[model samples]
Target: MAVTLKAEKREDLNKSVTKQIRESGYVPSVVYGKDKESKTISVNSIELVKTVRDEGINAIMSLDIEGEQPVNVMLYDYQKDPLRDELLHADFYMVNMAEEMDVEVPLHLEGEAQGAKDGGVLQQPLYQLQVRSKPADIPEAITVDVTKLEIGDTITVADLPEAAEYEFLDTEDTTIATVVPPDTVSETDEASDEDAEPELVGADGKDEE
Candidate 1:
C-alpha cells in the first residue's frame, strides 16, 4: 500500500526560497527521469515523512499530481536537518515498468544466532543491497536466517535467497554478517592484566639494569 500526498507548484528555486518553504511546513523536492525533464516540486514534510515511515525508504510510490499525469516513482534522496531532525528536501526517481530497475532492499536478520547462544557477538555489516528486479516483483526487505551461524560463520552475498528477476550488484566477497567468539578469561591473564611491577635501577630506567 502507498500513501498518497497532495502537493502544489513551487516557484522558488534559490536557497533562501527553499529555507522559507521549509519554514512554512513544506519540503522542497524534485522529480526527474531519463524520459522527461527535471521538475521542481514540494510536499508537506509531516505528510511526506508519514507516507514513507510505515514503508521502507525505497518503497514504490504513486505520485498524484493535481492536473498533470500520475507518476510512478521511488523515493530517492531525503535530506534531513542534523540538529533538528527535520525533513528538509526529497528527490524522486522515475520508475519504468518495462525495464528491470536496480534497488536496495533492507536486510532483516531472523532468529537468535547459535554463536550468540555461545556468548558470541553477532554483527551484521550490510544494511542494504542493490538488487535488479521489476518494480512489481521488488520486495520491501530481504530476510536472512541466522540460527545456524556460529562463531566465525559468515553469510556472504551469495548466501542470500534467490528470486527469478532479482540480480545482486555487489561482489560475492561482500560479508553480510558474522559471529565472533567471546574471549576466555584465565587466572594467569587476570593476574598479569592488573598487576604491574616497576623495576628500579641506579640512576637509570632500563630493563638491562
Candidate 2:
C-alpha cells in the first residue's frame, strides 16, 4: 500500500526559517534522488505523524508537492526532539520501484523461549536485519519463532526463514537471539582475596625468591 503526503516547497533555508515553520505546525524536509534535483519542502506535522504511524518507514510514499505532480519516495531519515517528541526534520529518498535497495527490517520474535520457562535468560541481541529487495517488495517485518529455543541455544542469521525475494545482508553466523543461564557468581569470584599481593617476576625472567 502506498502512503501519500501533501507538502509545499520551502524557499527559505535558515535555522530561523525552520524554527518558524515548526512553530506553524510544519516539519521541514528535503527530497532528493539519483536523477532528480534536491528540493526543500515542508509537511503538516500532524499529517506527517499520521502517515508514518500507519505505513511505517519502509512503505512507499506518494509525495504530492504543491504545484507539482506527485512522486514516489521512501522515508530515508528523520529527527525528533528528545524531550518533547516533536518531529524536527525529515529526508525522503526518491526511489525507482523496480530497483533493488538495501534496508533494515525489524525482527519480531514470536512465542516463548523454552529456556525462559526453565529459569534461563532469553536475550535478543539483534533487533533487525539488513536485507536487499525491491522497494515495493520490502516486508513490514521478519518474524522469528522462539518456542523451540533451549538454554545455550541461539538463532543465527542463517536460521531465518527462507525468503526468495530478500537477500539478507548479514553474515550467516551473526546471532539474532539466544538463551543463556541466569547470572551467578563464578568459583573464581568466591576464591579471590582482595588483600592478596599480586605475583612479581625478576628482570631475569624468573619468579622472585
Best by lDDT: 2
lDDT of 1 at 151: 86
lDDT of 2 by residue, 92-155 (tens): 9999988999999988889999998998777888998999999888888889999999998999
lDDT of 1 by residue, 143-196 (tens): 899999988899999887677878888898899989876653255458787796
lDDT of residue 11 for candidate 2: 98
Q: What's the TM-score of each model vs. the native?
A: 0.81, 0.85
Once model 2 is optimally superposed onto the true structure by TM-score, how far is the C-alpha of residue 192 displaced, in angstroms? 18
Alpha-carbon RMSD, each predicted model? 11.5, 11.2
Against the unseen true structure, what C-alpha lDDT does each candidate score?
Answer: 0.80, 0.86
Error of 2 at 1 (Å): 3.3
